[model samples]
Target: MPQDFVKIAQRGELMPGKMKRVDLDGRRILLANVDGSYYATDDTCTHEESSLSKGFLKGDTVKCPLHGSRFNLRTGQVLDDPAEENLRTYPVRLDGDDILICLT
Candidate 1:
């Protein structure tokens, strides 16, 4: 694993179609599992700064619970209204049973 990438969870810790929030280095990161594939993104919504993990996750789109803002977990693109800016995405790497997230 790279020095910038740190293990956030185990492979079995998160099930498919579920999401979790990881607080590391004072930053909140949203980790999602979709069909065994993992993706990481900023937990804060671009519109209202609400935690995205508290919202809804359907497919790869995560909807903000506060203002209905939706963002793509894969590419960090905004997909719905009420959000003009896109969320920041992180690279997720799987090493054995470890789920690692890139900080840079």
Candidate 2:
């Protein structure tokens, strides 16, 4: 079986191109609003364990605050090195005014 939706925040709360950190169960999730869509990824930076939600966001890429490692917000892929590990992506859905993250 797979884990289902985890409520992160209200849709009206996060502005586009910004991110917020949410704790779901025991996992730390970085919830980002890119353009008009929402995305969820592991909050920890793949390299130095820095909080990605505090990192810089440019277009669809997020740069690690500690070492400049970049990651694709949509796919959670490692776009730049020093951060060799890919981020774990969570499925996101907009439920009315709430943001639902599928942990499955």
Candidate 3:
């Protein structure tokens, strides 16, 4: 199947160690720029549906602001409890300053 890549954010729009939330087709996705590298994951925390974009980014891990569930930004792995399910990840691509995400 062909992948549907969508331009989500600009390269430098989100600085290192920061995160932003992008909505595509009603799906909220969290975009994290960790030391110039980018990662994408579902914005909602699995534990209680809180927005992960409102959380804190530590290195490559994002801790849920509500319940403190830490998730690895690189692979969307649940690094801490309160969120037993891993976050869904999206493929990220860079084209010049355009940050694209594969939604499919």
For residues 21-46, write the lDDT of model 1, one tens digit per residue: 99998899999998899999999998
What are the per-model C-alpha RMSD values against the true structure? 1.6, 1.3, 0.8
Clashes of each: 0, 0, 0
Clash pairs, candidate 2, are none
Q: Write the per-residue lDDT of candidate 2 for residues 1-104, one digit (tens) a residue.
A: 76578678998889998888998888999999989899899999989879998899998899999999999999999999899999999888877898998887
Better of 2 and 3 by TM-score: 3
TM-score of each: 0.95, 0.94, 0.96
TM-score leader: 3
Candidate 3 C-alpha lDDT tens digits along 1-104: 78888999998689998999999889999999999999999999989979999999989999999999999989989999988999999999998999999988
RMSD of 2: 1.3
Candidate 2 residue spans exceeding 4 A from truth: 1-3
Error of 1 at 6 (Å): 0.4
Clashing pairs in 1: none
Each prediction's Cα lDDT score? 0.92, 0.90, 0.94
